[model samples]
Target: MLSLAAESWMLYGIACVVLICRYVSRWLQLGSVSRYQIEDYIMISVFGFYTTLLVTMNIVVHYPTNLIQPKDVPNLTPELVAARIYGSKIVVIVEQTMIMTIWGCKLSLLYFYHKLTFGLVQEWAVKIVAAYTCITWLLMEVLYFLVWCRPFTEYWAVPTDNIQCTAATHHLLTNFIFNVSSDLFIMCIPLPLLIRSKLPFAKKLMLCLLFSLGIFVILCAVLNKYNSFKHYNNAMWTYWYIRETSTAVYTANVPMCWALVRRIFNLRAFNSPDRNGIAKLPETPNIDDVPATIGGGEFRKQTTTPQHIMSAE
Candidate 1:
């Protein structure tokens, strides 16, 4: 448990730094925080929930909980049972915050995709995926609070006969399915666009790699569910929960930091011809600066600027 706490905090710290950079990149690109896009603000809110999850998970680890086997339940004192019940309640908070943090990242990515695909046929695909993501989140919440555990109090009931209430096997399964599938759907939105763009093969590959970081997030989700199912008695899934949320936060923000990166390094390779046939970077990066080759070549004749070429890379 000590090791898990340490790992969780370490990952959370890294995520914080990445998110700070993401905001700085956006601020620099857009001139001020007032000009920040919707996705940028969404991620900020998600980070708030991420912080809450980390704090709640700490409480869960340190607090007593009735996660013991049936044989051990008889041994618990009234005071100990009460403590366990309180811890069990904290567990629900952890679960809810985790879901919110992960899904919030998903929503941020969908909005970014919506911006990326705007003015192109792919915009419709982004809209459809966004709807699907939102619907899945709603259904998952319903299954969690209303369908899976009846009476709700059973979730923290001490020495309860209903294992499902405590272990939350059904909720974990449904969450895993929803989490992984939504991640896959969001990832699919950018790959084909990057592939079809007339940019250099290396740049395309690099951009695709940036978007593909979602794969790691998916892997973390799988590990989280696997451990929850296979080792529920020991509460081993907590470590992976932290890892999964941290990875999701990272994947969502890293792509947006490219503009800052380019500005810091002064990378000139992104330069392309404008209407006057002169190649240069924009004074402030914006989605409009992206080369027309991205959306099925529809923006080919558009003025070229690398300001926000891969705003959500």
Candidate 2:
């Protein structure tokens, strides 16, 4: 029972920290270019939504974190039942927020791809499809939560009242269907480009893994859907939802978060970061550029000193 309360938040906390680190690293590297991008702002909004989810979960009253036995129904007082009913309303909001947060993060990655594949993908149709996918998620899934029921209150009352409600099963299946399908669409976009790069086989494989990390988010969506059937308890289900939310946000941020990890470890191999609009000129160093004549193998760059300046020195 305690695991229900603790585990999701633990994961959410880590995800939140990692998301922050990703942006912090970006801002440190690119200033406003990093801070103000549509993708970066969307991630911040998603993190805000995730934070609201955590707060609402703690503040609202939920059911007995265990299975609701028939005997326990009698023990449920009017106040407890009312609070639980109110919690149901909050859960509906949380569910909507979850869809938004998860898809918002996903859209951010898609937008990243949109920018990434701009000139790289020459065909207009491919870019149109990617844009349409983001718009479809925004219009179809997000609004589906708002209008799924004829009267929205009816949707929340099912937990506490004997109200006839639409089948959530169908909506969930549709939700996960789009979830995984869009995931496939986004993951597939840059593959041909990456595969054709002059980069060696190992580097290409690493890029593939980075882009395809969303598979874990898809896995979480699958597991959460599976758990929905096995654990019908409200509190337990809430934990699963939180896990899904955290994984969504975490996976979305990780493509950028490696920069933070590299910095913290003093790693330089992948030291590349956005250096603003300036193009990095290659260091065309030659043998004459090095002062190898210095004693004890100590070397300094050879500076061209004027003849008069050298004589004065």
Candidate 3:
């Protein structure tokens, strides 16, 4: 119960910080590009939705209990039946958040790709990748829920029959593999192109750093995989509360951290709260609109600075 409370509060606090940063970024017009703006909203939505659900589930799980069990006839104790029900809900929420966050990360990657690349082929690649990512993760979400819904008691307790439940474990493994692969793919996609851009090593390094937040996401996936493998057949309560919360904390924070980095660097386009020295650039064509000659090739505007990008890395 204490663990649940701590996790809930931490997630709530993170959600609040992200929200404040988002509004500040918007007010300052720090986030000027359309793609960046969309990624910001998506990040906020993912964090907000997950945290809210988790807090609510914790409330339900910890609500005042006063049920009389037949076994304890004289001295009645609070029935934990509701805890099981709510516990299952927590697992579902955790799985949902993780799946959604994976999608959010993929979208963020695609948005950066779109902003950085301009040719027709590059544009098509972005669209195709976005479509595939959304579809795959949506299917994974559906699979998770279907597994969660089988023989309701099986969710809150162990099944009497040795028969397997839905393909939840399989789905999770698939999702984990998919996410890690996607993270590596997204991280590598622009490297060769960046190398060809002929930008200074410093500039190229900065761009790579900005996209490197995906590494944290991959790390989170690894942690989740380890936790799941270590606790494959535990009681539902431990399985749902401990393992699920750990995954939620790591997965949900990825995008929030990413957004916070954008906010700190004043990269996203909203007006800064204290405009002491960082002069606000005009909201035209975005920083990515300028085409500079790199390597032997000319690339469009890549406005990200070294410091701003490296912090995220």
lDDT of each: 0.78, 0.58, 0.49
Q: How close is every model to the real structure, measured as TM-score? A: 0.88, 0.73, 0.61
Scored by lDDT, model 2 comes in at 0.58
Please provide, for model 2 over 27-142, each residue's C-alpha lDDT reduced to its tens digit, 9 standing for 90 to 100.
Answer: 54444553457778888788888888776766543433212355667787777667656666675666667787878887787666554543332235357656766776766655
Note each model's CA RMSD in angstroms. 4.2, 11.9, 8.8
CA lDDT, candidate 3, residue 115 = 46
Top TM-score hit: 1
lDDT of 1: 0.78
In the range 86-122, model 3's lDDT, one tens digit per residue, is 4545555555665564566467557646644544235
Query: Which parts of model 1 have CA positions greater than 4 angstroms off?
Result: 269-313
Candidate 3 lDDT at 216 equals 62
Better by TM-score, candidate 3 or 1? 1
lDDT: worst 10-residue window of model 3: 288-297
User: Between candidates 1 and 2, which one is better according to TM-score?
Assistant: 1
TM match of model 1 to true structure: 0.88
